[model samples]
Target: MYRLLIVDDEDIITDGLYEVFNRYQPERLDVCKAYSAKEALDWMSRTRIDIVLTDIAMPGMSGLELSEEIQKYWPRCRVVFLTGHSEFEYAYRAIQMTN
Candidate 1:
């Protein structure tokens, strides 16, 4: 089963994605939701998260900071940004860092 973590301030976005991922993914994906970056980090310390789907604009910490922190704590955990921002610049930078 693929353990998934989704972080977004918007409840609807995270909730919708959780349903979609659970319905479509071939693996028995276990999904976790965090309303903010802080909550996501807290959950990470406790559970084994395989992937993180996050919104770039968060209350306390932006997705970029959370991604960096995840790299430091769990290098193997993959990050997929889900942002409303039209600019791809942030995504490019994040992708480069991930690689």
Candidate 2:
């Protein structure tokens, strides 16, 4: 099964994504949610995550930093950043991090 982690500081966003993923019933897809980067890190340490969908700007650690962490610890996992137009610079930085 493909494990997906949705990380967003806002409860609504995470909950909404979770519901959408669950409703779609993607082939062997398992969805998890985390409210912060730290929480997501903790979850990743315990679970095998295939994909990480996170917001760019968060409370403590940014999504870019979280992606870097995933690269180091869970190198096989893929990361997708969610950001607003105002955070385009952060999103650009996130894209650069993979390179």
Candidate 1 local lDDT, 1-99, one digit each (tens): 889998999989989987888777646888888999999999999999999999987888999999999999999999988888878897787778877
| Number of the top-ranking candidate, with lDDT as the measure | 2
lDDT of 1 at 40: 96
Q: Could you tell me how far off, in angstroms, the CA of residue 11 lies in candidate 1 after the best superposition?
A: 0.8
Error of 1 at 22 (Å): 2.6
Off by over 4 Å in 2: none
| Model 1: residues with Cα > 4 Å off, grouped in runs | 25-27
The TM-score obtained by model 1 is 0.88
| lDDT for model 1 | 0.89
What is the lDDT for 69 in model 2? 93
What are the root-mean-square deviations of the candidates from the true structure over C-alphas?
A: 1.7, 1.2
